[model samples]
Target: MQPHQIVSREEWIAARKTHLDREKEFTKARDRLSEERRALPWVKVGKAYLFDGPAGKATLADLFWGRSQLVVQHFMFAPDWTEGCKSCSFWADGFERMVPHLAARDTTLVAVSRAPLAKLDAFRARMGWTFDWYSSAANDFNHDYAVSFTPDEIKSGGKIYNFGTSGFGVEEAPGISVFYRDEEGNVFHTYSCFARGLDMMNAAYHYLDLTPLGRHEQGLPYPMDWLRLRDQYQPAPGKGACGGS
Candidate 1:
């Protein structure tokens, strides 16, 4: 491939204008799809699911935390897993800043995992996050959303249904489920999405585009191998050994 050339000011302006025009078209199409999505039929959640919160055990209704709307992210953390899934952890990290803004809009956001409350708390402490997280240990909430795998699923070696994708066994895919409460205090499931819908949490894509390497791989999952908690990361030898060396 030919090396990219640095363009003059006028050329830069012209290129930017072309990109902006394309972006505008993309935005219009995105908005139209969103409207279509909003028009879909609602599903009523008949089963009463339980979740473990910081304050203690709570029902699905209680997850609203007095807010009229609730948004739950099914985080990947089974009870026995030692650590949260790396990709899901990236998304969860954004919740700290988003929670306050969501609260102002009268929407409460929380992350639910199948892990025990004690285990979730310990992992959160290790990651140094302040966002609200809860345990769904006693319920089939994850399985219901097609985010958790069952023992039978593991044993069958057949296609396990999940997130509109079928192939080998199904594994937890990051997902978002929304719910709204009516005047009668009945909570109705409004919407849910997985995979591409979770793109808002992807900062690596933005960063990769600005780097020389670009995204390096075509079909791989998001580039999670490079990130680490701020305190846990260390620069490699001769990598950060700059000017003096």
Candidate 2:
């Protein structure tokens, strides 16, 4: 932490106004970038990707759930892992509450992981999340989306993600992929964002950004190095790997 500066009312107002101008510019730039993102060309999906969900086996189009637009969060949970990535869990914490709102907008949001459906269901129950989560265990969805890497790729140092083959250490990474379905039932890959690109989805991080501490992640090996599963926070009772489910 740094020393605080005390200033008169007028001085603080002037400083705030100057900062507000920069904030306005940033807002405009962000809107323009969003427009550009929407303008990006779409690619038709040709694979028969399959997923296991609460309703049994489903195809990529089935995951759309009658919605024209679909948003898939590529959760980093391997088939054998009993728990999901803590960072992804942070993002998932606030997602269930947005379901109806996203539904009203004709968009369906769901999480896809390499873990089996049983594992996903149990974990979701433990976390008390209601959002639809599916398993990509029987498909190439994760690998095709560049979120999952093979052991061979790791051994060969040949995995590529976020448009590059660097700065990654784990077999799985987090990302958001968007899709659109046409009236004729054809599906198109719309847009995808990885790394810190998905930061805006975390409300807690946004609130933290508004404070003087500002995420307080500096000097750490990783920005989220301090993160743990929601139940794992000390003084908070941890419900074991299976939780209460």
Candidate 3:
């Protein structure tokens, strides 16, 4: 817990400017990568997937709410589980505020989970999130999107996760999928990302990246090991006072 090398104002400015050049380079490179991602070919979504939301039954196109584009957060809340995944909750905490902004741009953002609508609604209320969350309990949306694995799939080694052949030993995984709807009501899957590819979508993670410690996940069994549901985080040690000897 020591401070970095101290420097005079002139020296600090010079060093910061040098780093700023590298940051700009990275920004440009990221812009190009985003362009490439948008250029990826899309696939037509033929399945008539349905979801149970607060407003009753909804289809994939209906989730868009008259918007041409949709962003689905594949939340990992299994029907058998009492609550949503902590990691998924961490990701969702950043979603509520973006709903209106996304709608303004002709895009809608919503969450899709396999848990029943009542469970999803109760948990959403507990989390105090206003984002539209829907249940895929009656549809193959979660399975088709590669978020929820079937019992047979798990028993035989769930290898379809993250688009890899490695056997994932879990019934649920987190992901995001994007879709587009044309004038004729045709829906298409434009993009989907799993695992670490979703890093950019979490604002807290990006904010952590700007600090000196940068997530501070070292020495842990895994990244996000320190995370908890927003309401579950314990008060910071002493609320900032040092411990007594």
Per-candidate TM vs. native? 0.85, 0.93, 0.92
Better of 1 and 3 by lDDT: 3
lDDT of each: 0.80, 0.91, 0.90
Which wins on TM-score, candidate 1 or candidate 2? 2
**Which structure among the candidates has the greatest lDDT?**
2
As a TM-score, model 3 comes out at: 0.92
* lDDT (tens digit, per residue) of candidate 1 on 1-245: 23987999999999989989999998999899989977888887889898888988899989888999999988988777888877788777766678889999999999999989998899889888887899988998888877787778767776554444653344555788899887677988888877667775567566766677776664456455666554456667666624343
Clashes of 3: 0
Instruction: List the lowest-lDDT window of 10 residues for candidate 3.
Output: 236-245
Ranking under TM-score, best-scoring first? 2, 3, 1
The runs of at least 3 residues in candidate 2 whose Cα sits more than 4 Å from the true structure, single-residue gaps closed, are 165-167, 236-245
Q: Which residue ranges in model 3 land beyond 4 Å of their true spot?
A: 1-3, 237-245
RMSD list, candidates in order = 3.3, 4.1, 3.1
Q: What lDDT tens digits, residue by residue, belong to model 2 across residues 125-184?
A: 998999999999998999999999887776776537786746466789999999999999
Residue-pair clashes, model 1: 0
